[model samples]
Target: MRNQLLAVLDIVLSARLVNANVIRIAEEAHKAADPHLALALVSARGTTTNPVEIALDLEMLDAAVDCAKEALAEIEKIKRVVSKNVVELEAAPSLPGGDAAMRRDAIQENLDEIDEGFQICGARLQEMETVRDIADKRRKALVARV
Candidate 1:
């Protein structure tokens, strides 16, 4: 019975870890999606005719996009683990200490957090992609002019 309880605890901890990671990634993605970044890109395009300056600006935008892509990949991996953890949590036997309800509640809370993290990350990624597209267009125009 102790072993069963420990197993459930382990699963809960694992799920919590994944949820934390998701939240961290979402936060990073939010930074990448900052309006200031988009505004800077636009300002660079409108105010700078120098190819070198434009190139540098585009590079910064590209880096943000790359960071967002990496975060997205990490989120996908975390999602798979979260799914497995949810299954394990559901199948966990009742704890010996009569804390099964507590465990269930924790699992549900973690799941909710993970879901919210995914939504936030998704929106941020979309915003980052839109910024990247604008940078791409500017870069192409610069290339054509040179």
Candidate 2:
């Protein structure tokens, strides 16, 4: 029974860690997918024949694409971590005695949190993908103009 309690505690701690990671990744994704950054990429016109201006625009587009790709990768990591946590929660042993109900409740709460985190990550991933696509298109357009 003592071992079972310890196992439950370990699972809870692991779940908390996963949640923290998810939060961190979401923040990163939010920064990478900033609406202003996307707008800047979309609004930047390579119509000017100035070599310097075109080069600068290309550099900016490249940076945006890199950031978006990194964010997308981070989001994918979060998804995998969350999925693993869900599995752990499911496999956690029920505590003995009156604590059994409490353990079940804690597991359920962790699952709920993981589900919410997954949903949030999904939205962020979509946003990051959109930003990446816009940056790619803008970069191509700029390159073509050059």
Candidate 3:
């Protein structure tokens, strides 16, 4: 579980640096285009750059990932727990049409639920990745004095 926690924890923890970089760069980019936006970014960057806030945001992100992972773990545990009963129910020797079909339906439903959650998480992660990549390139350009 601890190892699983660490693995799943990355969804939030590592993403923070990505998100921070994104907001910082995007804000700078938006601001660079205009005086008013730059002014707004200046205010936002200050709050964002604060050490306390940075740490808090990072922890919050990690916790969100952890919660998601915890829920996933629970589902997996549930699948395992019910699997035996599922097999027995579906495999009953006297049952008509077979218990396997019944088990299949249950498993399919559980899988569908898992797939839905995973898709949402995947979309969010992809957005973060897109933002981070843009931010990195922008920073590199600025550093190059471009």
User: Model 2: per-residue lDDT, tens digit, 1-146?
Assistant: 78767766776676677667766766775665565455544445334444455455445545655665675566566556656655665566555475645655665675566567557656655654555455456656656786
| Per-residue lDDT of 2 in model 3 | 56
Clash number for each model: 0, 0, 1
**Top model number, lDDT:** 1
lDDT of 1 by residue, 49-93 (tens): 666666676677667767777887888888778777767766777
Best-fitting candidate, measured by TM-score?
A: 1
In candidate 3, the residue pairs with backbone N, CA or C atoms under 3 Å apart (3 or more residues apart, or in different chains) clash, namely 90-99
**TM of each candidate vs. truth:** 0.76, 0.58, 0.40
What would the C-alpha RMSD of candidate 2 be, to one decimal place? 4.5
Which parts of model 2 are misplaced by more than 4 Å?
A: 35-58, 97-146
lDDT comparison, 2 vs 3, better candidate? 2
Residue pairs with backbone overlap in model 1? none
Q: Comparing candidate 1 with candidate 3, which one achieves the higher TM-score?
A: 1
Specify the poorest-scoring 10-residue window by lDDT in model 2.
40-49
Off by over 4 Å in 1: 30-40, 96-98, 142-146
Q: What is the lDDT of candidate 1?
A: 0.71
Worst 10 residues of 3 by lDDT: 31-40
Across 1-146, the per-residue lDDT of candidate 3 in tens digits comes to 45434433332333334334433433443233234222223333443434444344434444443444444454444445434443544444333354345444655554455445445544543443343344334444444662
